[model samples]
Target chain A: MKLDSAGLQILSRHECVALLGSVPIGRIVFTDRALPAVQPVNFVLDAERLVIRTAVGSKLAAAAQDAIVAFEADEFDPGTRTGWSVTVVGSARAVREPEEIEYLAGLPLHAWAPGSRDHYIVVGTEHVTGRRLSSVDVG
Target chain B: MKLDSAGLQILSRHECVALLGSVPIGRIVFTDRALPAVQPVNFVLDAERLVIRTAVGSKLAAAAQDAIVAFEADEFDPGTRTGWSVTVVGSARAVREPEEIEYLAGLPLHAWAPGSRDHYIVVGTEHVTGRRLSSVDVG
Candidate 1:
């Protein structure tokens, strides 16, 4: 897929939503001690919000108290050197209502790691954007 | 890259370190308002430490003031349905010395987005691990 400047721009947005809808996993980015940190998380698209799961003592549970965060997901095709990335910038908050919890439970979000996996983390999108790079454009 | 139990275990560690070395950009996973949040960042590998750039009044600055964080990176091959992911769990700390800053400045990290990217966030790997998924395995 040869992406011209305009095509790259359009594909960035289209791919953003497409990747968001096709996958339930993303990277949660934030600052920890003046340094950048990222982690893989199982997420669900709740309306315009992205929701994830964590534990009580988990790092995610401690840092997201009234803070801004960045969430991202992407799909890359090495053969074609083509890929798209979508990033969501927003504040995170815990879901407390029983009804919402019940709704979230039905989603396919599961922790691939073993250990304590109990808490749920939700990132609300304040800014949503994406980008794409292709092999044809490289050479 | 079909993975048996043993292969999965070994691949996990390799994936984690490989991710740390492969990409210059990543997301920081933190907590805000009791929910999980993420942000994009430019980083460098300082030995086993993952260092990133940041600034004051940034969400990362607020999140890393004294909390645990999860850092991650990955490369996935959708055609073969195989990919590897690595995650680092650790505490975040600020880089205070001028010499350290100068050393970090010499690394190959660059920001993909335009913004105030001055502060440096460094997350040391207290624990590092990864996983690989493949459709075929020889052993």
Candidate 2:
């Protein structure tokens, strides 16, 4: 098992994808007005791609279009001080085609916020990296 | 109670800072190699600023220096579909003064990862905005 400099275990690409699929919510990082902006989102993994549904006119839908964005998901326990974080850095493109939107709508992706989320932003898994800190390795 | 377009409650600056102090962990968004990167970190709020302790030569310490960055912290309950998310967009600067570092060391901010974390990155809370979703507002 490869370990990072901080002694956390470096997760493999496959492990990263698996861990990402385990979580329903994630945070997306994009540039807004030339400054970095992060927003928590609900997403689903589809064949190594992260699909997020949001309002068509939301800031995320505008800023994330055809931009290099970062997506992160993790689960941590304060009492145990153990958790795993997976990050995917790639280009985010809004899905526009009718057939593709129909297929994506068939997925189990649902928005938690009360709104008409009609836009789909898909981020490829170009660079997938993850680190896990187990209870045994907690210092 | 101001409601965002998505029906989430818009939190005031006072409420945002209070919620930020409630969480010990947060995600920091910074630029790496001209691309956005997000990393989860252990941090503590000092008044209106966020203090992060990291290794001296880490990427976070390097990428966040004198740059605009985003810090996000939140708590969510999946079953109840309720949570609060606070985002702070501000400039990040490294704590170089020995006396200031010494003073920061006195804070209860302890690094979770096993390593010598002697570097402190302080992010100013310039534009703080937050949203809260309650169970009663669930759709």
Candidate 3:
């Protein structure tokens, strides 16, 4: 296991993507009124791209268009103090093509929030990084 | 159960603070190299302030100094389809004063990562907002 300067294990890109696929929810960080804002979102990983469905007039939809955003997903066990976190920094853009929307609509991406979530914001996996904390092996 | 325009329940300021105390982990969004980045860290809520401990030369400590960042903490039950998320947008300043650092070091804020985490970053509760999604009560 490779460890970073902080003593946390470094995860490869493949491991990060796989861990992302196993999670159902994540937090998307975007600029709101020129300040950083984070909102919990349910997203689907499609071929290294993050597909998020939201309302057309929502704040996220407006801020994420042709913007750089950060998406993070992780699972932690506080009891044993073990977990892994994966972060992706990339450009986000809304899907405007008809055929693309139709294809995304069938990708099993369901919105947990109430209301019509027709806007599909896709975040590219341009930069990916992950870290893990594991219990020290004891004989 | 007051619902917002998006049909999600709006959590009061008091509720948001209390929920933040219930959890020991959260995601902090800050700028890294002029782009947004999200890192999960263990934090403690001191009254209305959020305290985080990190390494002195780590990226978080460097970027969080006197910067406006976003902190989010939430808990969700996937089986019940219910969750609540609270976000705090405020300025994060490193505790440079020796007296303040000593006081903060006495708090229960502990780092989960294995490292010499001596730098303490305190985020004030400038703008706090929260939303919740609950299952409809049939009874």
Those runs of model 3 whose alpha carbons end farther than 4 Å from true positions after fitting are A136-139, B136-139
Alpha-carbon TM-score of each model against the true structure: 0.57, 0.96, 0.96
Cα lDDT of model 1 by residue, A57-111, tens digit: 6667777755777888876654554566788888888767788878877776655
lDDT minimum window of 10 residues, candidate 2 chain B: B130-139
What does the i-RMS of model 3 come to? 4.8
Instruction: Sort candidate 1 into its docking category.
Output: incorrect
lDDT of each: 0.66, 0.90, 0.90
Superposition error at A84 for model 2 (Å): 0.9
- State which candidate, 1 or 2, has the greater DockQ: 2
CAPRI class assigned to model 3:
medium
**Cα lDDT of model 1 by residue, B14-104, tens digit:** 5566677876555667776664565545577878788887665566777886578876777654354356677777888877788887887
How far off is residue A120 in model 1, in Å? 14
**How does chain B score by TM in each prediction?**
0.81, 0.96, 0.95
Residues B1-139, candidate 3, lDDT per residue (tens digit)? 7987667899999999999999989999999999998999989989789999889999999999999999999998777668999999999999999999999999998788887888999999879999998853211
